[model samples]
Target chain A: MTNRWIVLMVLLPLLTGVLSTPIVARLRLSRVLGVVGLSATLIAGLLLLNNATSEQAGGILVSQMGGWAAPYGISLVFDTFSGLMLCAAAAVTLCGYVAALGTLDRTVERRYFHPLMHFMLAGVNLSFLTGDLFNLFVAFEIMLMASYGLLCLAGGEAQLRQAYKYVLLNLLASALFVIAAGLVYGMFGTLNLADLMRIVRETSEQGEALPTGFTAVSVVLLTVFGLKAAIFPLWFWLPDAYPTMPVPLLAVFGGVLTKVGVYVIARTFPPIFAAGEAAEVIVPILLTAAALTMVLGAIMAVAYRRLRAVLCMFVIVGVGFALAGVAVGGETGLAGAAFYMTQSMIVAALSFLVCGQIENRVGSDDIDDAGQFSWYRAAPWLAVVGFVLAMTLVGLPPLSGFYGKLWVVQAAFTGPDETPGHSVWWLGLAGLVAGTITLLAALRWWTGVFWLGREDQTEEPPATQPASTGPRSLTLAVALLLAASLWMGVAAEPVLALAKDAGTNLADPQRYITAVLQPETTEPSYASTHGTTTPANDQAHRASPSTPEHHAQDSTPPATHADDRFGPNHPIRLRGGH
Target chain B: MTAVLAICVAVTFAVSVYLLLGRELKAVAMGVFLISHAANLSILAMSGSPILPTPDPELGITKRPPISDYDFDGALRHGDIAAPLDVMVDPLPQALILTAIVIGFAVMGFVLTLLVATSRKVQTLDVDELATGEKRHDPVERPAADGTVQGGAA
Candidate 1:
């Protein structure tokens, strides 16, 4: 029953968005719907988390759509990692929505804002929960589409241009995604992730080589995900586009979209491609990319004068951490990556919210132009909250941020095939240095905005007048996020435990595959050879000269090969072999 | 087939670079579209050629075609007619290209709208001119006032 509501937790927001579109003209009702739907989703997410914790030993709890099992129907798995992401997404969207509600003009509110926000939340939720690769693509589109709407909601010239680029880049990514999905489907004859895992393993064991087809698919998938995740070469468009959205929308986008891409990459890598030498090559490249991303993002953050732009840079930093963590590719690395992602999301969102507050008070986000508002005197509580969140972002001790970094550093140093000597050590050191630079950058920005005293009188008054009183609701929303960040930082044990469990699940993907595949009363014959002999042989075969011919032969529909691969009463073997 | 994709990719890459360097916003957008198409084509090429139909042995064709008679895959396979398209074009890249095309269209549309809005609001399409940074406070501010304000020294 609780699991049932978990699915609804995501669906409710989307449903409300769709249902309320007709009545969007009624601003009050749209507001009501947005709050109610998101609030309910938040509660549902919390409830799901509690249920998951209580039943931690129960393994992964799966809710299959339409009551069909794996390979036949779509499955939504609720594990510790996904559950945590779901809760974080729900919390961020809820807080961002509440914050924007108080300050968003009624006209803007009525014009698709509420619906889009809800849809964005729904998309984020779906991205976290879906067990199908194609479904992940769909979730991405849902989120991107909503983001497009949200990005250009203000209809400013600059925003429109930026939004265009954002939309275009993402659309290209989606297209690549579909093609990748089709390729994967063609190779394995299955779109279900669990089924793919089984098939990949079996093919390798059957002494069948990996087809060039799979390699092409893997590269394309990586490129698409890289574009979305904002890896160094592909990240130029993000800083430009993200800062243009309204602060609240920016906060959510900053926190969620790219992380969704990271999650996909993380989820898919160890399970499907762990055995491939390609993963080995890819990891080093990813590490290099991570280093570039970190240095570039930090430098850009320092260069930017706009508060929102600086926060956007931090988003890149977070992505870099996730990339580095993933590139390390072990239990500890994955845990650290997961922990870092969660912490980064919280901190990034808080920073954006604070930036929004400053923007409201100063009537500008430009650091040089923004005069200190005596916010400590004017909005003391908000200032305190903002300061705490900033400290968390800087990874000061006792905060969630510090723990996340610690986990990643520990993973980097202690992981099983630890890279010897200075290379991994340097990478780890670079990460630490990046973290320190980010901290200093945040501190510098904070000092300028909060503690520098008002700018000299010679500076021109900002073109727009500041709002007399910061919106009460907005303040409360920031306070809520601040409190949550601090609380997560202070009482880090439980969440860290959950993160650890999530990381473990991610690292050891057999449980994930089993949870989804659900070896029932009728055991699958192919299941036995999946992780063992077949996958390795298949990988070798793929690398060998006869791959093209073998792939052509293997591409034959499963219906034709199933009987030969596994006799009757041996469904698992058949499933695994094909 | 590879040659065709290669040419397309090269041409598109050049055009994209040229357009990206251009000052006109429209050219930039069009450049992006072209580059994306080029990328799509490149992906298709990378997937290799599709499996060609097996030649009819009865049609006066030998069991093993001569070196000159076969396509790339056949040439590689040493005229083995039995090899079902060993290099059948990977459908994944094609699928990916298709997705890229659709996304390109959506992005293009959004960008077009933005271009039009920017031109109207800023009253100047030149990015350099717009960089003067005269803040336009209201959505409904008159175009003339904006022009005068930025055009004037103060």
Candidate 2:
């Protein structure tokens, strides 16, 4: 019963958003509808997570759309990993939406903001659930389209002028995505992730060399997702593009968007590509990029004078730490990555919301004017919240952020196994140094804003125009996020346990493939038919061209040499292409 | 035929990248438009040769030999006669191409509107000029009527 409603996790919000737009406009129920739709989706995701974690479901729940089975139809597979991601995305977005209710301009709120946000959430949910590679591409498009609108909705001339670079960079990534998907389809004869995993696993299991194109194709896919994730070489567009967004939207974007890319990388790397030869090439490059992203991002965060700019750089640093955990590659490392990502999302959202409240009080986000007003006198609780959040972001102990960093650093130093060469000590060192720099930067920003007492406080009027008792809704939103982060910190044991389960499931691809295919009941399966021996060896299969499976499907003659053009023999398989 | 299509895709992609790197907003918009087409074309190529214009007069579409039936087994496949189903005119890539085209069109429309509005406001279509204009027009840097800087940028 729960399995059947998995698709609704995406469809409900989509329908609510599309159908209620005009209705809500007249009745002024956009906010109500948005809240109802997202809360429902969040509940559904939580239920799905419960189902996925249960013993009977075996950590995965598969829902084939339109009664189609396995590779032939698009399936929505909900595993522990995706379920966790879905919950985090929904929770943060809900916070952002509620915050927007208190903060956004009336005009911007009235102008399709609810619908667009719901639409983006629907996309995010679909991306996490979809089991097919092409479906992932579609999901990315849906998300990106909504984001472009949101970026410019409440912004001014500065935003309009800078919007092109963001659009163009995403457009480039999308184009590359298409090219990569097309190539994968051409070579693999299927776009279903489970089927691709099966092919890679079986080919490697049979001890036959996979075509070299697999590495190139995987690298290309990484580059595409990497650009989305805002890692080192590809992250240049993010800091420039993000600072101009409305604070509420920034909270959501900062929390969710780049993490989607991280989620995809975590999902794909361990299960599908790692089983093959690609891991050897991918791991070093991934670690190197992760190291660079961490150090460079922290440096820039310190260098930037503006609050938004510094926050933007910290987002990159968070991405780097998550990626470093993933590059470490074993169950422990992936568990660390998953835990860190969830923590990062919550912390990022909380930090931005706190900053937004500060901006409201101070009249600007520039740090140079920090000493002119004492935040402690204006709103004591907000100042305290900001200080705590700053501590969390810098990875002070007993905070949610610290545990994630500890796990990643431990994994990087100790290697996932007893293997000596696998330990990423330098990456771990880079993470530590970056953490220290981040601390300095966070303390600098915090003290300047909260601790500094104005020398002529009695003489000059307060710069804060808004009453100290501003909208309660604003504080409610911030408190919600801050509470969630604190809960995560205090209750790290169970969360880390869940993350470990997700990692365990991901590290073993066979579990994912079997759960999706359900090979025992499904007709003889693709593996049974084509995977008798050296699966792609054309010469061996040529003698028995029309397998029984082909006959079973239809009275169809097998395409001569069609199998030869795929797998290891395809022309795209250039030696030493990397 | 595949080689020809590959070359066409490569050229389109290279040209789009060049346009994308240029300073003019119009050129960048053109690049965005061209890159989508290039992406669409590359995906289309995966479906098999997209019935391109051939230089050889004998191999023209009207004069080209019709797809014939050839079967090693006593079986006929669905669209199997069209040079085997998967190898020639795979519908999946066509479906992919169609989706890409529609998405590309929508994005291009939005981008054009944004660029046009930006260009009009800044009174320049060149990105470099727009950027300089932005610095000049920034409210944060602008001085008030009484000679005090706005936005508390001390």
Which candidate number maximizes DockQ? 2
Please report the candidate that would top lDDT against the real structure: 2
lDDT tens digits by residue: candidate 2, A43-96: 888888887788877888888777666666787888888888888999999989
Q: Residue A237 of candidate 2: its Cα lDDT?
A: 77
Q: Write candidate 1's Cα lDDT for B37-110 as tens digits.
A: 76666655545221113332222222221112337455647755444443334344455557656756766676
How good is chain A of candidate 1, measured by TM-score?
0.87
Of all native A–B interface contacts, model 1 reproduces a fraction of 0.09
- Give the lowest summed-lDDT range of ten residues in model 1 chain B: B145-154
lDDT of 2 by residue, B34-149 (tens): 98889888876665332211211222211111122244222235532223332333467778888888888898888888887877765567776555553334546632221111
Once fitted onto the true fold, the runs of candidate 1 whose alpha carbons sit more than 4 angstroms away are A1-5, A201-208, A416-423, A454-469, A519-578, B1-119, B122-154
Q: lDDT tens digits, residues A74-191, model 1? A: 7888888888888888888888888888877777777788888888888888988898887787788778878888887877656644554576567557656665775565445457
Instruction: Please state the error at residue A87 of candidate 1 in Å.
Output: 0.9
